[model samples]
Target: MPPEHNAGAEHMLVSMLRPLVERGHDVQVWLSRYGKAHRAYEYRGIQVVPLQARLDFGTAARRADVLLSHLECVPSTAALARGYGKPLVVVCHNTHRPSLRDVAAGQTALAVYNSLWMEREAELFFAEYPKAIRPAESLIVRPPVFAGEYATRPGKAVTLINCNREKGGRVLEQLARRMPDAQFLAVKGAYGEQILPALPNVEIVEHVDGAEMRERVYARTRVLLMPSSYESWGRAGVEALASGIPVVAHPTPGLTESLADGGIFVDRNDIDGYEAVLRRLLGSAAEYRLVSKRAKARSAELDPAAELAAWCDAIEQL
Candidate 1:
């Protein structure tokens, strides 16, 4: 029950947790609990209890019946939860697990993947730990974007998210330089500071929550720029499309599937293809309108609340 550190994780947690609380299940969120940033509070009427860091096992065991954690950070939480005989649920997001070298060192942990690709990775990971517990198949849940408040795109700035610099910053910066006419907004903070300030045309804003993020990023956004190296279903792309904004990206793993034909993909380093696609979309009001319309229509099919309610039903059965 760690209060997740990232906005995407937070959104998913809120969506899933809210329903469970309404159904009368007690919920507690543990994190870097002693830190000032980690405050105990209520969210949507659910009481949030933040446990202090380095807390004793006896204290943690008294609190909950289950331990739900992210896949990558599973080892410590799983071990602790297992010691207390609590049911552990690992929400897997990545398609790859730690290398064989890490496994041989006795790191046996549970994982529940977001997609089949990640589930396959978990199988490979558990090959090294015969006793490793895997999260129930019923626990596998899709990452969700907040819906209902989608806005019509104003066909202005090319919205680029500088999530990970090693992943997409250089290309976005270069594109901003080339397409000087196109205004670029970097969903900025932490990692973004490295490149966002250097580009004069790029405006940087602190991270946004689900609903606000959808409205703000989609409101004035012309095209969504996602040049990611990898993703477990790029949430931003889903949000943009849900808001009737088109995305242009490189065909990275999860993103390729998530964006589908709702996006235009450039061949790796195919700057010309990228430029041409952008120009084509920007050139015609009619073409832009059609793409935006199709993007939202595609996103509507993956309804967050419906999917979340289904997930909650499965979890309650556990």
Candidate 2:
């Protein structure tokens, strides 16, 4: 998931798809709907072409057997796939109305939901548009994480991976101020303007690759914080769990579902509540160990071997 300039959702998608290359599949990812101009390049074996490139996406997509897309591009991708008379595999990452409405249009041959809650949300959307048809097949295929790759000895720093406003950058800033002596790590995300507050205790780390996260980020992290306003699925939290690092996050549907028993849930707005939880984990060694043990246990439950195999089968079946 080469994360230098990537967000969680795209990173997760790439990680889940990387194994297909090893299995001897010809995988080419096309960025068709971006307004910005960027050069095409290869990540690992996958060739990624941006919308601005001389070779148009429509020409490339025409030659390809199937089309894969998510987010804001779903509606247009559906149209393209329908027009081309090709199968569409739409990855449902969120409950955005237009995207779901587009999925209900019946052009999508396969609907890959990131979580069960998302799958249920899709059902509700189906009810909302009763006349709209459904995809032929739909399944939950969570973003896969290789536990061993992410596992590392947890450190003492309280950390938040992305310091964007919606991801609760201000919440992190307030927490740092509340606890002057406590060390905090704020990692800048690949996208968005990061809120870099002037605080002595809070250390900011520039974005790094997902391969470098274990050593560069998580190695110094004891507690992972995600105070996102919304999260489709908390991949960072799950990655933290792999290393026996306790995650303290806002009770977003994704965090609650993905973290399960591994996370320490705290409302981002409840500053007092967030402070107390942090103090307990940071102060009490026994409490930290207990939570760390739970984190490791949760990570074991989500072994990526089976999930990745299932994902590959679905992709091949498409």
- Worst lDDT run of 10 residues, candidate 2, spans 1-10
Q: Distance from true position, residue 284, model 2, in Å?
A: 1.1
lDDT by residue for model 2 (152-232), tens: 999879998889898989988999999999999999897778997789999989887777889999999989989998998
For all candidates in order, the CA lDDT equals 0.65, 0.85
Angstrom error at residue 82, model 1: 1.4
In the range 1-318, model 1's lDDT, one tens digit per residue, is 322334455556666777788888887665533443445676665565555533554576547666666534456666766577776665656665452222222323333445555555656766866765444443456676655655554548887765457457667777788888878887753233446646778887656545466566678788888777777667778878877788888787677777777877776477777778888888888998899888877787667776667766666655
Top candidate when judged by TM-score against the true structure = 2
- Stretches off by above 4 angstroms in model 2 are 1-4, 33-39
Reference-based TM-score of each model: 0.83, 0.94
Candidate 2's displacement at residue 313, Å, is 1.7
Superposed model 1: Cα runs more than 4 Å off: 1-5, 33-38, 44-58, 99-111, 124-139, 152-155, 189-193
TM-score of 2: 0.94
